[model samples]
Target: MSSPRISVILPCYNEESYIANAIESVLNQSFTDFELIIVNDGSADNTLSIINGFEDSRIRVIDQENLGPGASRNNAMRIARGEYMMFLDGDDWYREDALEIAYREITQKDCDLTFYQMINYDDETGDIYENDWFNLTTLDELDGKVFGPEETPGSIFDLSVGVCQKIYKSSFLRKINAEFPEGIFFEDMPFFYYVYLKAKRISIIKEHLYFRRKHDASITHVVDGKFLDTVPAGQVLMRIFIENEWYEMYKFDLLAYKINGPRFALRYIEEKYKIALYELIKKDYTEIKSSQYYSDFLENLGPVKKKFFLDIIASRNYQDFIKLNS
Candidate 1:
């Protein structure tokens, strides 16, 4: 059998309430020649049953023990038979024309990847809002423009790290071995940087075609041990950068990313995890501090940003850090 032009990969975990809408959205896309790959990540609820209720042949369901989202996505990608790939969260749905527009633009542009605009839908209060966080619309000059990561250097970090907000050329992803890191939270951080850095061509869709659902139970609202996964996640990202020889070229952007992402994330996580998170951050920074690029990074940081890293390294414990911040 010939492969479809696009494959939609949806990884679900107990998304019984919203999976139906998610499935229906893809099955009803304006672009008809596509397959939907749903990974049931050991959903303990009626999610599997709900998924089974759908009688579409284009829908392929993979049942697996609850591996993290990273693992689920990897599994789906391995078996996905598509020229292009799109990721969808189980709780989110795409506009009917999303696939049609994205596929057309990507093909015409010959882009390895194309990201699009996403609006947030709050199920609790019925609030719908657009976030200008994705560089797609904010960088007006880049609208429908074909660009590459190496052309922008470290600015690759500036793009949205949300994997679901984009469509990927399956061949490019496969060629680059862009697989998600299992057993880590914020896996998308490293994964996004991984793919973007290796991408030869990237484009954007200015139209809002994806809906990101937000609710209390969402991972963003949770503060737990997994929050500390940001440290290891950052660690993995640092390794990718340094090993790829990007760390030296973009040390400033890389350090700033660490400070903004994992370091800053410490402020919101549970208090109990602070010491551990601190130690992890300190450990990573300590290694960087001794590296040859550390001085160069500090030079690029000016005064204020340099102090933040220094403060993290100099502090005896979280209390000292708090007192310094206070």
Candidate 2:
């Protein structure tokens, strides 16, 4: 078998119920020039057996002890041979033409990365809703525009932190050593941020090419101490931006992100650790506000966000800040 043009990496962990459907979606893609790398992260269930049931030569399975999804992806990436790489979680599946559309746009536009939209599928309700991060109605206007952070800061910076929504050029990823932070809960935060910074040309397809499954068993839905990983993830992203001088270029977006990141922790973190997480975010905010580019951030904020910022700065306690923001 010749090397495929695209590589789809699916990392599984105890997903026996959905693993077969996910694999079948890839196999059934209209675009056939691809390989599916399935990394089973020590599923204590029947996930491994289901994966073994697929006899297609294009499917390569790597079974390892549970090392988390980030490590599993890194392991698959090392042996990936495709020109472009994409990720799919074990519980999630893709549209049949997803690879075909993404491949066409990326190859035709000659972009380093291509981000397509997704649909959120409610497991219990069986209802689907468009992922409206871009608020775009049609793909006709912005289908093949090749631009990066400098030209399209909002699009680049405001993208969801899920790596599954985008397809990356394998060479570009290898060039920047953009591997996920192993054993981290919010690894996508740092990984996708680094990719956006290093990407030279990015394209967007407004079409919904991926489906995200939202369920109680999903990692992001569970409440645990690991949720606090966002603090360190934010710090790692900030350090990378500062060290590479990207902070100044995208200061406004970064500022908004810094202020809002703690809100996610507040929502998901356990009550006892809330104050510590707030303090950590506040410390980062202090350093960011002290930067020379902070004035630029202030000037860019609208009245509402500006007032929120002032309230945050003036509040003496986390509860007051949350109340003011709320």
Q: Which numbered prediction scores highest in lDDT against the true structure?
A: 1
Model 1 — TM-score against the truth? 0.93
- In the range 1-326, model 2's lDDT, one tens digit per residue, is 67799999999999999999999999999999999999999999999999999999899889999999889999999999999999999999999999999999899988898888888888989998874563333333556688775665555555677889899999999998889888877788889888887888988888889988988887677655676667677678777888888877776777667555655666677788877766765665566578775686578776765665566566777898888877
Error in Å for residue 318 of model 2: 8.4
- Which runs in model 1 stand beyond 4 Å of their true positions? 290-293
Candidate 2 clashes: the total is 0
lDDT of 1 by residue, 1-326 (tens): 89999999999999999999999999989999999999999999999999999999899999999998999999999999999999999999999999999999999999999888998889999998886685354455677579877667635666689899889999999998999999777888899998888888988888888998888778786777788888888778888998998877777778777677765678888888888988888887788889876787677774656776888888888789777755
TM-score of 2: 0.83
| Clash-forming residue pairs, model 1 | none
Q: Per-candidate TM vs. native? A: 0.93, 0.83
Off by over 4 Å in 2: 134-141, 272-326
